[model samples]
Target: MENVKDLNHKPLSVKQYAIVSSLLFGLFFGAGNLIFPVHLGQLSGAHWVVAMLGFLCTAVALPLLSVLAISVTRSKGVYDIGRPLGPAFALGFMILIHATIGPLFGTPRTATVSFTVGVQPLLPKNAVHLGLLVFSGLFFLAAFLCSYKQSNIMTSIGKLLNPLFLVLLFATFLLGFLSPMGHAASQTVTSAYVNGSFFNGFLQGYNTMDALSGLAFGVTVVTAVNEMGKTNPISNSKVTAKAGVFAVGTIGLIYVGLVWLGATSLGKFNVSPDGGVAFNQIMNYYLGGVGHAFLATLLTLACITTAIGLVGAFAQDFHKHFPKVSYKVWLGLMCLASFLTANFGLDQIIAWSTPMLMFLYPFAMVLILLSVTSPLFHRDPVVYAWTVVCTAVPAFLEMISSFPPVVSQSGFGKAVTTFQSNYLPFASAGMDWVVPALVGAILGVTFHLVLKAKRNGAVESEKED
Candidate 1:
C-alpha cells in the first residue's frame, strides 16, 4: 500500500477542513464524554456555570492542546511526546496509556455507558443484566469486525451517526430549554460542589480522559490532514490546529448544553449516580416513550463508532510495537476483553476507572504541558524526567485516595490520603501534583543550566592552557 503521507498534496479547502474536524470530534467524543458533563451539572446545580468553566479547562482544553502538541512537535503519539524522557520510559508510558483507553477501561466503557443511558431504561428491570450482556456482545463483535479489516468504517459511520445525533440532541436541548423544568441558577448545589464547584468540576473532567486519547490518537488527525494535501509538517500542524479548535470548540459547546440540561432537569428528577441516568431522565421527559428508542439508537451507534476507533488504535499500535502478533489477533483479544468488562455495568466500570484515570491523567497533563513548551527548555531530558518522577509520586497516592470506598477507606489508603493532605498543595482539589511538578521543572532547568555553565568553563580553561 502506498503511504498517504508521501502523496502529492495541497492545502485543504474549508469544507474539507470541516469534515476533518468532525472526524476528530467524533473520535474524541464518546462514552465518558456523554456521561461526565451532565453529572457535573447535577452536582454543581446552582454553580453549574463555574463548574462548566473548570470542566472546559481539562476536558475540552487539555485534549485540544494535546492534539496541537502532537502537530507542533511532529510526533505520532504519546510515545513520541514522552521520548524526551527515555526510550524505556516512553514505551512504558505509551503502553499504559493505550491500555487504559483500550480494552482495559475505555472501550468497555463505550458499551456499558451506552447501554446504561439508552437501552437499560427500555428493558424490564430483571432483564437489565441479560440486555447488557447481549448488547455488549453484539457491540464489541461489530466493532471488532469493523476494526479487524483495517477499514475506514469508523469514519464512515461517524460521518453519518454524529450528524443524526446532533439533530436529535439539539431538538432535546430546544425542548429542555424552552420548557425547562426549573431555572438552573436557583437550583441547590450538592455537598461536593457547594464550596469548590470549579475545582470539583475540574476533577470530574478527569473522567473523560480525552487528553490521553488526544495524545494517543493525535496521529490519526495528523494523518487526516496529510491526506487532505497539507503534507509539509508546518502546514499540516496549522491545519490540525484549526481542525482541533473547531472540533474541541464544538464538543465544549455540547458539554455546556448537556450540563445546562442536567442542571435544569433537577426540578423534575433527583441527582443520579451517573450522567447516563441524567441523560435517560431528560430524554424520557422530553420525548416520552419514543425517546427511549431514539436514545438507544443514537447512543448505541455513537458508542459503537467509538469502540471501533479504540479497538483499531489499540490493535494497530500493539501490532506495530510487537509485530509477531497480528492485528486480527489483537483485535479479537481486545473485543473479548472489552465484552467481559462491559458486563460489569456502567456505574461499576466508572467507579473502577476513576483510580486509573486519576493516575494517568496527571502524567498526560504534564506531558502535554511540557511537550507544548519544550522549545523554551530545548526539550531537555532532565526536565521531563524530574517533572514526571515528582508528578508520579503524588499521582500514585491520589490513585489510592480515589479508589472505591471499600479500598480507599482502608488504613493504608487513609495513610496515603493523610500524607497528601498534610503535604501536597492542592491535594483537596484533586491536583496534588501541581506544585511538585513546578518545583521539579524548576530544578531540572536549573540543573541543566549549571551543567551547561560548567562545560563552558572547562572549555575556556582548556583554551587558556
Candidate 2:
C-alpha cells in the first residue's frame, strides 16, 4: 500500500507548471488592459519602443515577481506575510484587497468597458447612457448568479473565452496593420522615460491591480493543488512555482502582442489623450459595424468574468475577517454595491480608482518586497515595521498631492499634508515615495544584520564566561 501510494505521487514538471500558471495569469488579463498601450502607441508614434519598454516593465515584471514571492514563501494564505502586523493589519489588508478587486474598481469597470466596446456603437443618439445602465444591470445580475454559486462554469467559460479573445485581438491587429488610414505625426515629449522608465512602467502596472490580486490568487492556487491530496510543502511549492511560470509567460505574450499591435496601428491613427476614443476610432475605421460589435461582446464577456472573480475574492476575504458573515451574504452585498457603481460608468470608475490605487500601491509593493526578502532578515518584526513605515510615509504624502483636498481634508488630511512638505520628495514626477522606500529597505536589512551579529557575540561571550 505504501509503495503504491509513493508510486502515484509525482512532482509537477516545468511544462505542467507553465500551463497552470499561464491559465492563472490569464485571469488577470481583461478588457481594460487593451486600451492603454494602444493609446500610448498613438501618442508615442516613433517613440513607441521606449514607451512600450516602460509600460511592459510594470505590466509584466511586477506580476511575475508577485507570483515568485508567493511561491518562494510557500504561504498557505495571503495574510501570512502580514504576521508581523498581527490580526489588525491582516484584516485591513483583506478589506483593502476585497474593495479594490470588487465594487470599488474591478466590477464597475466591466460594465463601462463593455458598454463602450459592445453596446454604445449600436445604440440610438440619445439612448447611450440609458442603454449602458440597463445593460450593466443585467450583466451584473448574471455575474452575481455565477459568483454566488462559485460555479466551475465561470472557470470553464474563462478558459474557453480567453483564447477566443486572443484570436479576435490578433485579427483586429492584423486588419489594422494591413489596411491604410491617415497617420499622425509623431512628437516627443520631455521627461517621457527620462525619470526611470522601469519605475514608470512599474507604476503603470500598478494600475492593472494584478499584483494586489495576486495575494488572493496565491491562496486559490495553493488550495486547488492541496485539494489533490498533496500535503507536502515542498511539493506544493513546486507546483505553485510551475503555475507561476506559466502564468507569467502567458501575460508576457499578451502584453507584448497587444503593445505591438497598438504601436503599429498608431501609424494610421491620430494621437489622442483619450485612450478610449482612440481605440474606438481604430476599430470603427478598420472593421466598421461588425468589428465594433465583436469588440463589444468580447469586452462585456471579459469584464463580466473579471467581475465574478473579483466579487468571489472579496467575499472569501471578507468572510475571513468577519466569520459571522456568510460568503453568500457578502457576495450578494458586493454584487449590489458593484451594480450600483456600474451606473456611474467606466471612465468614472477608472478616474475614482486612480487616487485609491496610487495611495495603496506603494504599501502593497513594499509588502511584496518585504515578503520576498523576509528570509534574509529571519522574518524579524522590527525590519518589517521600519521598512514598511519608511515606504508608507512617502506614499501617503504623495497621495495627498494627487488626491483632491476635499477627499483628504480630515485627521488623515492634516497628517498627509505635513508628510508631503516635510518628508516627501515632491520635486520629481509625483514619485516622492519611491526613493524613501528603497532607502528604508536598505536600512532595514542593515539593522537586522547588525542585531543578529550582536546577539551572536553575546552568546559567544556567555560561553567564555
Query: Number of the top candidate by TM-score?
Result: 1
On the 0 to 100 scale, the lDDT of residue 366 in model 2 is 78
RMSD of each: 2.5, 4.0
Backbone clashes (count) for model 1: 0
lDDT per residue (tens digit) for residues 250-290 in model 1: 99999999898889989899999878888888888888999
Q: Candidate 1 — worst ten consecutive residues by lDDT sum?
A: 1-10
Candidate 1 pairs with clashing backbones: none
Candidate 2 lDDT over 246-306, as tens digits, reads 6666666666655555555555555566556667777777777776777786676566656
lDDT values for all models:
0.84, 0.67
